[model samples]
Target: MASSLTKDSVHPGTPGTEKTFFGHPRGLATLFMTEMWERFSYYGMRALLPLYLVAPGGLHLTAGTATAIYSVYLSLVYLLTLPGGWVADRLLGPRKTVTVAGLIIMLGHLCLALPAAASFYVGLVLVAVGSGLLKANISTMVGHLYNGPKDARRDGGFTLFYIGINLGAFVAPLVIGTIGENVNWHFGFALAALGMALGLAQYLLGGRHLSEQSAVVPTPMTAQEKATTLRKGLIWLAIAVVFYGLVGFTGHFTLNWALIPLTLIGLIVPILVISRILRDKDLDGEERSKVRAYIWFFVAAAVFWMIYDQGGSTLSLFADASAKNTIFGWNFPVSWYQSVNPVMIMALAPVFAWLWLWLNRSGREPSTIVKFSSGLVLVGASFFLFLAPLSIAQDGHKAAAMWLVGIYFFQTVGELTLSPVGLSVTTKMAPKKYASQMMGVWFLAVTAGDSITALLSNPAIGGVNLDKMGFVALESVLAVLAGVAVWMYRGKVNKLMGDVR
Candidate 1:
């Protein structure tokens, strides 16, 4: 039986490692709230970004310019996880690293509050790097809260963790974005900073529970461990700073520029090569097999996010352009419609949690990989469901609100299938020594898929035909590709995973 948070909730047979929070670890709730606030800041800022820049006399950028900046910011935010993962694994543990990152992010939000073109670049840089560190590592710590050999409870914990994410997301646009829209744009940024401050406080308050876990397993060093860590830290910082400066400057001027490709090649490719090298260079039996499964899961999740992340890019635009919604006898900001997915996730998660446990009682539950592949198909299927309205409409008129809601519903379910599971898979399968590294790779897939979404929305290529069946056509093709990828690799992938069920 698990212990309670007020007292240490230690697992049976694991002494000294008492669980800390509501039937979970003491630190779990702390991290949960931290993530909640961080996400609140992120999604809140996201709600106002293009609207702030492109709406009326804001920045007055053309659609292409706005989308370019949006996509670049999105891509960089995910891409920096490579360094973030490296820093946590090699130098700082997840806990402290996230501490530094939260500060950076808070500073970034402050920059956004500054009324200058230069503030845009500085604020985004802080946000991208700060998010890169916090995103992968905080999720990893939730796994540590469960200490057992291949502990099955981990996924449920992560799903719960994700619920915190959606909760913050649900409120962010309504609260911060709404304030930014009606009160002041800078106030929205200040709100984001305030949220980050709260996250840092929770993390600091809960540091005791996290001290036990190392973001990475230790490696032998010729010099002292602390010294070696410091050296690597400086090196990583220098590299990141150089790239940050370059990207910050280039992004302001060069569209179709080096930022995406350079960032991808500079950061992501090395991780890929390292993972492959690790796959072939070291391990022998099942360990190596798990490594291979890690690769497969990463590919599958990338495809999933490509479609899923539309919530920010295409879906954000859809809300602004298409959906019709009103609350309290007034039209809610169109962006707030984006809240429906997170809201659905928050409401549905407990039901799915119960459903999974009930199914397990019957000795029937889908494997994580199967769920992931199925998520792609299900989410992809939602496109057709949405396309139906546009297909049948007599003219190129906006589709009804039901269509957007239904699509978000399917996307939320699909996220439930794969996303939380993907995190557990990485933590379980990755080399104990390379946990954060694999997490970084997992994030890379997301960056890749999301970048493709950005590419799709590039107006030079013709903005997605939102009023027609065009968005549906694009996603349908991706779904087919995802299905094919799954068919070809499922056997190899499942075998590597051993008895995951």
Candidate 2:
């Protein structure tokens, strides 16, 4: 039987280890490069997928259908993290699981590189499953790189790591997206494969830098439990294979209908996971209270992402349809807008890092809930910026490229405020036994947000024919109101934290 998780069970980084990367642990570099390259592949592919769907000589799908697939793919990519985290926590260690996930992701990119439509569908499945495996566990490993309870450097380390992530995000669209958009789609996917391969190679070469504890599974299943788990996994694998086969062979499979099941999964999984954790007999009063606070954070994050993550779907469409592509007669790629986020992140992260340090030193740091509220307001404001001018743009006169840039700039600000904080807090609040799973729950909020974006992007779902700006305006208002409400309840939420913040 697996030992129950407790707060003390987490492995701390090697004490007195020489700081090789930015005065942080040597492992930080390993993870930093690994995540950077991973994001490059992931975001590069994302930048192309929607465009490919609507392009000639491609899937040639409608905007609604293409975005629905995009949304489902993104949702599944994060949703799978729950099981992926479970696998790492209970079966393979984070190190091994992440390695395997990297390999699968490489294969997924290769699948996309093939010219066949079937390859495209199969590739999406592989990437989504692989991403699910890698995302939560890799993040959890980052948390493991520091000593808990006394690690003042945890948030700063994640902020620095976030820069690496944005670096990849910044570069990928420029490189892979250019070739994908202008030259050939499969070729672009090929470049993404190359990126992942490089990342995997770097990870293998730099394994020694990582904390030794990451290699040890925290919870080990008993023989009986392992058998049951294996059986269930195989059955699900078989079902997935059958479903993929049906979709690949019979042209009757509809992505719109597919959303129904995904919606159910998105809705049910978090509830079950949260309930299981909260009802755990292992939790003390303080831990239970922390879990409640975490739930509130989860909701706030979902709301924020619902607005911010439009970059891939609705925002991408706007870039193509509404935004003027020419900058001083030099036409930029639609995908290039995707790079704006990473560029801003790269520019602003250090500033925010310094700001947080200053705030902490001055004893004026925003409470976690307060920061979350600020993020929500900023994301909402990004949408309103778009609505302000585009709402009045004369028909057929494309909005300026600066408008999209402005939106992404503010959205990046909101992301910096919430994303790193969300990762740091989840790690702090997680019950030791369920650490990886809790991280998965935090990502589940992203999954829910992505699902909502997908649904809203669908014309069949009343997302079409609506004045896009009006919708953005309404959503922006709602998000701002939601942020204010959370801020009002901040005291109650802080009480739930019990001095952790």
Candidate 3:
């Protein structure tokens, strides 16, 4: 909103004469279409996973197990970004890294299209790792496109990029979800794989347009450093093998095991990142405080995403089980409900973009912290809105479809306020040396939130009985409490940000 963010932290290259997409770099078009298709594949598969797991022809998992697996899958997708981001910065550049990851993602989706349990599990792992590799770097590359001190177009470019993300999301559920629910789930997965393939093809052909900065590792290691890194990597690989072997071999293959390790990592990674940033000998006090400020945003973002991401798990189940689906004798596939979010996002994104620009110009834009708190409040209120209609639903009667529509509307608004702003602020507040890693850390919040959403949706752990009035009420209260906490800390957090706004 402040209009001063630049691509220097990501690209650090001189502006070029290239003009291909919207009067910006030709690379923007490449990145835009690439991310668009990637998101389509990701969300298309996501819209089907939970339902597929519970379907008779599929895994036939219980609701708890289904949601749990979904949780781990989504969480790991973001969690692996920690290491993926490190790889991008220290070994492979974002370009090659994303390209390779995209290929893996395509293969992963194809694996899902196969009708085998082994393939399913393997596919999840591949996609998670591949998504981790691509997610953080792709975003950083977008930032790289407008690299300059005076680039006022940076935020607008990101806004346009964000719209592409929603565009993909908007179309996926309608197309893939409909096919998955109506045709066959595996076929649905194949469609997702095809989407990724298209994206990969485009990225390969268009690689020339990307900034040169994205093509080189930001911090190349010397031979000795590479040896040390390889040793550490092998050690970690061994550790992971042991962990996975134990988790897989044992009879205890519950989702809780998956959730526990990631939860611990989620907790620990932020502490280490913060400590690393604050302890940097290169950073002065102001920069150190800025890193500290980022931690607050990080936590608030996790809270928001945990609640918002329920749309894929708990809310998807609700759409199938509780919501009314009929419209003039046409029954909507439960998965189609997933489209409501991106549809609202597509319609309202421009309005939000305009609002932010207008507010920034008027010097009336809220600080990032307040905007985050506002998002928390709005998301919390959405859950409360669910209570009224759901609480009064007669036996055998589904809740009105408008309830979900309303819920997603509010969620989208909250998303507009917090998500784009969060990305902008993360780039702004991050120390230049740690920019890529910080982006991964920001995604870690999403990992934590998504994992938390799954954990809470587990009826055994959180006793999530959507049929009862208490569950929604409890979540509403917790969100409001989180919002209040953010509100109370707003002034302190702003001070820590040190003129970043």
TM-score top scorer: 2
RMSD of each: 4.0, 5.2, 4.1
Estimate, for each residue in 262-368, the C-alpha lDDT of model 3 and write its tens digit: 65665566667668778889988888899888888888888888778877887787777777787776788888888888888878877777777678788896777
lDDT of each: 0.72, 0.85, 0.80
Better of 1 and 3 by lDDT: 3
Question: Residue 170 CA error for candidate 1 (Å)?
Answer: 1.1
Worst 10 residues of 3 by lDDT: 1-10
Model 3, which residues run further than 4 Å from truth? 1-20, 148-150, 240-259, 458-468
lDDT per residue, candidate 2, 1-501, as tens digits? 001211222233443245445555667778888999999999999999989989887888777777777877888898999999999999998999999999999999999999999889899999999999999988888887887844767888789889889999999999999999999999999999999998888889878868887888999899999999789989999998898788868887666656767866776777788999999999999899999988899988988977877778777876777778878989989998889999999999988877887898889988788889999999999988978557646466778888888888889999999999999999999988888888899999988887877767676676562236678789899889989999999989999988778
Predicted candidate 1 versus true structure: per-residue lDDT over 1-501, tens digit per residue: 113234645464331245545445556677778899899889888878877766664666665556656766777787788778767876677777888899999999989888777786789889989999888788777767677536545666677788889889999989987888788888888899898888788778756655366444344343587787689889998988787688777765454554445434533573565567465655667777777667777767777877777666555665565555554456777667668888999998877766776676686877776777888887787776767656545355655666778888988888888887787777777776666767777777777776766665566555543334776677767875785678567787788877554
Candidate 2: deviation at residue 164, Å? 0.7
Worst 10 residues of 1 by lDDT: 1-10
So what's the TM-score on candidate 3?
0.91
Best candidate, lDDT-wise? 2
- Alpha carbon lDDT of residue 366, candidate 2? 84
lDDT of 3 at 237: 93
Q: Rank by TM-score, descending?
A: 2, 3, 1
Clashes of 1: 6
lDDT of 3 at 348: 81
